[model samples]
Target: MSEAVLPMSATPVATSRAPTDWNGEAMRRRIALRYAAERRFRLLGLCAVLISAGFLAFLLISMGANGARGFMSTQIKLPVDFPRSPIMIDPAMLSTNPDQVLANANLPQVIESSAQAAFGKDGDDYISSGAVAALRKAIIADPGILTRKVTITVPASAGIDLAAKSDGSEADEAAVVKLEQARALSTGFNGGFLTSSDGTDPTVVGIWGALKGSLLTMAITLALSFPIGVFAALYLEEYAPRNRWTDIIEVSINNLAAVPSIIFGLLGLAIFLNMMHLPRSAPLVGGMTLALMTMPVIVIAGRNAIKAVPPSIRDAALGIGASPIQVVFHHVLPLALPGILTGTIIGMARALGETAPLLMIGMRAFVASPPGGITDPATVLPVQIFLWSDEVGKGFIEKTSAAIIVLLIFLLTMNSIAIYLRNKFEKKW
Candidate 1:
């Protein structure tokens, strides 16, 4: 068996004429060349895909690198605790006069006293002199601080905060030295950035109030835009005839979507704020402006979504003796809900981030107090970021960037929802 070596039953002779054309050997070589070419094509496509992915990754990394730093903020934990012997803020001492308020007690002195009482001797160095101003602002904001000792969490000063979070490696020797003193002061967040209202001071400005305003604006957008848009879409797709007027309306809608957002802002101010004299910076006004801007988009999207639904569905509903309205509402609308919602969410989110119109209405101005309702003066996230980014402070840079990140996160989440709905509910008839 080891010695056995077998060949074909009939041994073939070697050919000198390059083997006959289209012989097995030649065919095999051609097939191999085709495979090699295909492999090259596939490899090129893969390289292009990888390059595209890399660019996308770079973009996201840039956003996260800048935005993630915002989350690492300066926070100040107060030594304040519940006091057994509370210095009753006699209601009589609640006066608006700065001198009378600071009369016998400077804001620093009062807060210092509170701190000593709370953390004892250990709390003396724990507080900063600037912390006194924060306390003053708090007291002025709420005169009731005279009644009870409360623990508050505030943001630390920018320099102090940056030092705590940074490893000192990123900063130059000079900047690092500048931050040394801030680091030496009792370590912790120097607060005001979290709970306070908008201000030029990066160390003092807060996002808490703006968060509420955006929520209200979105609420108004969803409440008003969805129903109106859907109805308009249904009418156009199902009931409206293809007439000259309808053609004009459709053209106008396309034009509206193309109109500059700022133009809408200007129109909003003219109609809602100046003419109607509604609250200037109210979420209601903002929502209305955005809704008007979004209506055409919704109508267009809604019409498309509705049109995409098979007419068979409508015919089937009508065959059962359903009225036109009933058939549409019950059968057609249900089928198009996913697309409708996707458009609505997209429009609402876009409206939420819009700032030019909000600025036209006066949301750029500072309000020491938060809004009480949708009609109250409000500032949204985009406008808030714009305000902060203009401030001439290193700290505000991170803060502005952080706000932008928050906005991006929100946008990404909304898009994800829309895509999810689209893919999940997509139908192939």
Candidate 2:
């Protein structure tokens, strides 16, 4: 029986020989493969970034090239006998009844007469159709100018403007050359494009009216949405019970964020316009509708930002006998402010660019004057661009591009401000 254990000795035991050969070559091969894959991934990421950047650069360059021409206009100097012009009224009448004088003064015929006397028949066509209105505006701005003989530089026709800028056909070029040789044609910066309002005449149109409306609309939107959104987020994150109703509300808010903007337009149409009887095309209505559209986005963003705060801070504040409200207001809110502002800025930018909802509420109308209050009829920059882009006139093309440039600049400014704020107060725990 003792001899049965002797069979185990026949099986030789094997131990490590140089620690299993270290497997260095296999490990090196695996490491090399991993590094190669990583390099390929990195290159792909760089290529994607470069492609996107290139597209953005192209868009900006195209806008600048086309829109730059809109900032300039062609002008021609004209010597006019103010008292002798057909549009001239008695100086006494101008002081006593300015509106009546302006209404009776046929400025178009007057400009036509001046052009004919200066350059002959059909020469008036080379002057902008808006020259009459321009002259009228000048006279209104300074009534005393009508008492003396004056030489005024007035806007040239759209055709001549194109020709002067070297963008027209050969026939147009010949006309421009003739005007230039006569010393009547000149080019100058278009100051009116920045200071005036929307008009059918492209040479006289400007974005100021739209810009002011945008400012007012955004003001209303911000005033309503910021506080509502922040508090709604606070309650949902800090105080709301985790119940079925809360869960439904949370889901509904998230879904609202993803809803198409046009749906909100319809809702606004039904509620704000059709039922509530708010003024159509007013900044008040537009802003309220946009506030509805934007509020959900802010609530979602704010909740996420609030959730990102570490629990330790809330606990620490509570341990010091701080009220729940006090903790939220003093400690948590300050820390979360940068993120909150980031969301708010993004929402405001979206509101600034929105057109569909505003259109539904009647902001698509041609608002020639800037709004004096939120309740006044108005059109925003985006709606203005939309209208201009659809015009049949060739002059409005450059104008549309210019409006787009303005909108882009505004968006850039907002995003820059957001970036500055985020970097200024961003915190880490």
Candidate 3:
């Protein structure tokens, strides 16, 4: 029955001829249409790039807008007249009406009152009343304000702070008084931003204490981190044996880098401040904490830099009668210098911006004194910024912005230097 059904097997039909293009342009046009029809991927890629660029520009613009005023300052101009016999001769006499006496005194009056005063009668017209207050503060700090009758034209609020502004204009809407206090502050040039201190009143606080603390912290971090990092890197990359213990140690170091920075803060609090009895809020303690956090990173980067150098270079140096240390230092270190330096600057930038660890170690303290040394109580920039941001005042808004700007500038400068160092001296093998 199957053989009978198979008798109907049909012959295969011939396929039709395929179409051919006669014109080259037409063929190209057809291919172009095909590609265009499949172009969704390219369009998506372009959209992604444009969106990312737009987001970046937006961030930069926002930071600039908020932080720009930090570069400018408000000033209060006051006329002063230093008058002779201005000394009250008693602290009570000066204390009874300090502001009143200051208000009544003009620049010429104050200057003329000082034995060291040197100014024409019109000098009072050119000085800031706010500046005179600062001088009075200095006098109060010293035991001399009671007997000193300096008719100082103190700086007033709303006067441009030159250090805080690039353009030095306080008349702009951004710097204008938004609150009664600011309006009150608008009386003359407070000594730019540098003379200010951290306080609940943004009008009265400055970042100087914070600035100095950052410097001291970074200095100690550099001093402690660099040598130790380099030494550890050299041992691990050049001399250490690769065993289970070594592997474990390497893993631990890597894990250390991943640890939350706040953990390091707790560690600093326990080990440095509590256990070791180190002073709280000291840069030394902060630096130690930060360096502990940074060490793992530095070691890793250093090893990578060393590893990037070819073994052949080492062999050549040894063949030329160089000792192991000389070969590594003279040849490998030079080649690795750029990467090492880049890592260092990056670490410094990280440390500079660190807040959590510093917070634990007492750097979160409201330190008003300029840092005396490594062991002195101090407030780093981020801590200062944090403190200022929490302050309740219309002026703190700008002060916070200003502090952020300063922090960003330092970070940017450090990064720029890193880039410069990397590019300027890097050599190809």
Off by over 4 Å in 1: 1-56, 74-105, 109-130, 133-155, 164-194, 412-429
Tens digits of per-residue lDDT, candidate 2, 193-237, equal: 887889888888999999889888988988899899999999999
Residue 425 in model 1: shift from native, Å?
Answer: 7.4
| Among all candidates shown, the one with the greatest lDDT | 2
* Ten-residue region with minimum lDDT total, candidate 3: 176-185
Arrange candidates by lDDT, descending.
Answer: 2, 1, 3
Give candidates' CA RMSD values in order: 11.0, 4.8, 9.9
> Cα lDDT of model 2 overall?
0.86
Task: For each candidate in the order shown, give its overall lDDT on alpha carbons.
Answer: 0.71, 0.86, 0.69
lDDT of 1 at 299: 84
Give per-model TM-scores: 0.70, 0.90, 0.70
Q: Between candidates 2 and 3, which one is better according to TM-score?
A: 2
Candidate 2 regions exceeding 4 Å error are 1-28, 96-100, 137-149, 169-171, 420-429
Cα error of candidate 3 at position 242, Å? 1.4
Which of the numbered candidates is closest to the native, going by highest TM-score?
Answer: 2
Comparing 1 with 2 on lDDT, the higher-scoring candidate is 2
Number of backbone collisions per candidate: 10, 0, 63
